[model samples]
Target: MNRLKLTLIRGLPGSGKSTLAKTLNAVHLEADMYFINKQGEYQFDPKELKKAHLWCQNQCKYYLSEGQNVVIANTFVKHWEMQAYRKLAKLFNAQFSIKVCTGNFQNSHNVDLLLINKMKKNWQP
Candidate 1:
């Protein structure tokens, strides 16, 4: 049997979380994906933020249950934000790991600098 691997990538916008996810050789998931439309356009709704995260988590759990490797990239500004995934890994008996990105690349979502600053200020690590 293949080992079940769960990787959580945390970083600020433009910090290369998504870029890193692509190379991890796992089923890549991200909370922001919930905001993207079928047409591949990103239309984020702040009101749906919680729901988006839940969706991401569910997807991760589904894939992990099937014995697939999964990697998720999200802002994860606070340390507690990653607890749910950690729990899921434990429940599924998957090897879990966390990677933090500190790059300053261009933020594809066009997030406001002020908001990014706010997230940086609240970063647990």
Candidate 2:
């Protein structure tokens, strides 16, 4: 049987987490997908952050249960933000790894550089 793996990609808004997730041949799950409307546009709603994260975790669990590798890209700056996923990986006996992207590419989200720098400073890896 193939080993199941779960990769968590963390970084600032413009740090290239999404880019790395796209390169990996696994289920690419991101909380931002929850904000996408039927019009095929991204509309972020701060109030729905919890719901989005739950959706992401559910998707990861579904994929892992099927013995597939999963890759999640999000600005998980703190360790607490990643604990649930780590526990899920343990539950499924999947290999878990965390990748931190530190690239300085232009942010697709258009977040300000000052905010990005602040995030980097507070980033807990």
Candidate 3:
């Protein structure tokens, strides 16, 4: 397979992006993981988000070059965020697909608020 295959999976904080990524055996890159590693310890500097993005971009390029699939797990709330990755995939001559996870607004809203409160309680900052 010479062409790259990219899968962009988007969902709110508590949805199953990571789970699906793992199940598919795809290269998983999560924004929250950019902040915290497998142990859930915050290891990245606050100023390093941009660097993280580039690193993830490079990783995607590398895996694609190896003809492997990728699953990018992120909130992807804005069109621009997803656009950047789409551009990257295009630059690499890769195929791309976007999967947006959605649910009832009231349920999603409640889940969002509940997650926010939980994060507040546990957030190191």
Candidate 4:
């Protein structure tokens, strides 16, 4: 029997969440991917955050239904922010784990370290 796995990579911007997600051989999903425009550019919109997350969740469900391992990378700073994915894991009967990234790399988003630190301080498991 093939067992499914769901990995959530949580961290603030500039952390290594995305990098770690890429390292895993799973279906990678992230809310930030919604920001990629047809022009192949990242255009973030605060108003679309909910939609982005919803899309990510939908993709996770689709992949898990197909018995594929999934990895989600996002700034899930609060416990509630992770609940949806946790529920999905349970629904799909996938082995679930959360990886918190603490490394402060030069973020591709160019977010300031101060803001990243603030997010880290406020982060909840």
Arrange candidates by TM-score, highest first: which order? 1, 2, 4, 3
TM-score of model number 4: 0.93
In model 2, what are the clashing residue pairs, if there are any? none
Ten contiguous residues minimizing lDDT sum, candidate 4: 104-113
In the range 1-125, model 2's lDDT, one tens digit per residue, is 87799999999998899999999989999999998899989988889999999999999999999888999999998899999999999999889999999888888867778877787899894
Least accurate 10 contiguous residues by lDDT in model 3: 102-111
- Tens digits of per-residue lDDT, candidate 4, 1-125, equal 97899999998897899999999999999998999999989988889999999999999999999989999999999999999999999998899999999887888877667877798799885
TM-score for candidate 1: 0.98
> Model 4, which residues run further than 4 Å from truth?
112-114
Overall local distance difference test of candidate 1: 0.96
lDDT of 3: 0.68
lDDT of candidate model 2 versus the reference: 0.92
Score every model by TM-score: 0.98, 0.93, 0.68, 0.93
Summed backbone clashes in each candidate are 0, 0, 0, 0
Instruction: Summarize candidate 1's per-residue lDDT along 1-125 as a digit string, tens digits.
Output: 76799999999999999999999999999999999999999999999999999999999999998889999999999989999999999999999999999999999899999999999999999
Please tell me which predicted candidate would have the highest lDDT against the true structure: 1
Clashing pairs in 3: none
